[model samples]
Target chain A: MERLAFELESAGPPAPRAPPVVVGVVASGNLEVLVEPGDLAGRCRVEVATSANGFAEIWDAVLRDFAARNAVAGLALSVNDAGATPAVVSLRLDQAVEEYLGQRP
Target chain B: MTPGNPGHLPARRSYREATARRRLAGILDPGSFTELLGPSERVTSPHLAGLGLAVAFDDGVVVGRGLLGGRVVLAASQEGGFMGGAVGEVHGAKLVGLLRRAERERPAGVLLLLDSGGVRLQEANAGLVAVSEIMRALLGARAAGVPVVGLIGGGWGCFGGMGIVARCCDALAMSEEGRLGISGPDVIEATKGVEELDAADRALVWRTYGGKHRYLLGEADLLVEDDLAAFRDAAAALLASPRSLDEGALAREHERLARRLADFGGCTDAADVWRAAAVPDPDRLPLLDADAFRRAVAAARGEEP
Candidate 1:
């Protein structure tokens, strides 16, 4: 397993009422994401513990893109991945944030 | 899958397809589920990390307390998506703790949503020990007047040591798709060869260990639809009337088993057992739906259909 951590700048923090949210499951080619409130003022911290190794650069790219798309400031995202592809990672990240903001469809 | 939906939907929502959290939400009262060791806690498997395997945040089982029809109850749902919901040290410990709590707290009931392939092969010894501990804890809770009901309808049918644990419950409800058995089909075929039991024969597999056959054999108290609402209603109904584990009950159970052995021990297949049970045209039984099948079984037993 490989561990990766990143902090990215955000536009603003989410609503204060947004409680901790978790989405997805840790299955083969799938992952689970947990989003919680963090102390960061204008940044979001993302940590990943994945079964697939040698993908730090890919993780960085995905996390950066997620931060760019959402205002996830003052939030921490933790991912437990089991060889999920980049597309699945992006989808789970969006789902985690959307669920945190009570916007799950 | 909103938390406060009340779950009276027109469409059939499959319990077998839902995640652990979703299943708990579907059964519990709206907005009443309070997870004890939630995902944010990061209580993952310590052994999986060392083995270079992905570890889940809640260790593949979701344990929590919730309200069922205004009564407080505890529930534990196994996440079959994670390592086939196998019982590891932490996963089994969480369930053990919940059952022990049920003994002390004496909740309305304990719901064990079992969907496991038995012990985790990676954490072999720890997983086996955990299954034993869970069984003891579950029986202990029952002896303390705490009703523990096992529900089986997960993607991975209950097998191995967990099958014994399921039978230890005060009551059990299984969907037609659910299965309860000691050795799984794959395991049997792997050890005894395909001629002994073809794991690829889905029809044979289901007939041998599926909920329908188990229910007909009086192994499951209730055979329900695969829908979540069906499971929820069955659990509620079972919590109202739990089986006693007293000396008389044990004696009766022993007698029942002995009689069964004498009557149908020579049966080679489920069809043969069904024939011995006085089900006319046993080959056609599987084609019937759940309600029709129940009626047929009742007729075979000389009960009102």
Candidate 2:
């Protein structure tokens, strides 16, 4: 497995009231994301432990895009991935954030 | 939106297809579920990190307290998506903790939404030991007058150690999609070859281990439709009638087992066992729905249909 960590500057507001939330499951071609409150000084952090190795660049791009699109400040997103595609990772990230914000679709 | 209050639930969905967390919500009262040792706690499997496998935050089993029809209850839902909901060191520890809590707290009942394929092969010995501890804890809870009920309705089904664990519960409510057996069809086919048991034949596999056959054979206590409300209702009703685990109960169970073996031990297929049970047309069982099959079995047993 490959462990990847990233800390990015957030463009959206910090989540102080939102509760921690988890989404998805760590299955083949799938992943689970846990979103918790973090004291990152208005920044977002992401940690990925994936069984499918050698995709650091793809994860980097996906997380960067997620940070830019979502209000993820003061939040730490941990992902347990099992060969999930970039799309699935992004979707789980969005889902975790939405659940954390007490919003459901 | 509280316990005993009817709230807006999702439209009818198959219990077998819902996620572990979703199953918990569907089973318990709306807005009364509070997850313990949840994914946020990050109490993941310690052994999976070294093996380079994905480790779930809640260790594939979600355990917590909730209200089931106005009564407080401790519950656990095994996530089949993660490692086939296999029992590892941490996963089994969570379940053990819940059962033990039930013994101490004496909640309404311990609801186990079992969907495992058994012990996690990745954890190997540790997983086996965890399952053993779980069995001990579960039986302990039962002995303490805390009813332990199980529901088996998932794509993976309950097999291996979990199957044994399911039988240890006071009662089991299974959906038509649920299956219960010690050795799974694929495992049997792999070990004894396709000639012994063809795993590819879905019909044969279901007939041998599915809910309908198990209920007919007296393995599953109640057989219901695949709907979530059906499972919830079944569990609620089962909680109202907790079976005893005293000496008398054990002796009766032993006698029943002995009688079953003596009468159907020579039978190789489930149809043969059903025939022995006096089901006039065993072949028609699989084709009938849960309600229809129940009626047919009742009719064959000379009960009011």
- B178, model 1: CA deviation in Å? 0.7
Error of 1 at B135 (Å): 1.2
Candidate 2 global TM-score: 0.94
The per-model lDDT (C-alpha) reads 0.91, 0.90
Candidate 2 accuracy as lDDT: 0.90
lDDT of 1 by residue, B1-305 (tens): 35678765558888999999999999899889999988878888889988989999999999999999999999999999999999999999999999999999999999999999999999999999999999999999999998999999998989998999999998889987899999999999999999999999999999999998999888899988899889999999999998899999999999999998898899999999999999878898888877788888998999987
Report the lDDT tens digits of candidate 2 across residue range B1-305: 35676895546778888999999989899978888887878888878987766799999999999999999999999999999999999999999999999999999899999999999998889999988999999999999998999999899999999999999999999987899999999999999999999999999999999999889878898899999999999999998899989899999999999998999999999898888888878888898878899898998879875
**All candidates: interface RMSD:** 0.7, 0.7
DockQ of each candidate, alpha-carbon based:
0.88, 0.87
Candidate 1 deviates by what RMSD?
4.2
CAPRI quality level assigned to candidate 2 from its DockQ score: high
Candidate 2 differs from the real structure by a C-alpha RMSD in angstroms, to one decimal, of 4.6
Pairs with backbone N, CA or C atoms under 3 Å apart (clashes), candidate 2: none
Instruction: Quickly count the clashes in candidate 1.
Output: 0
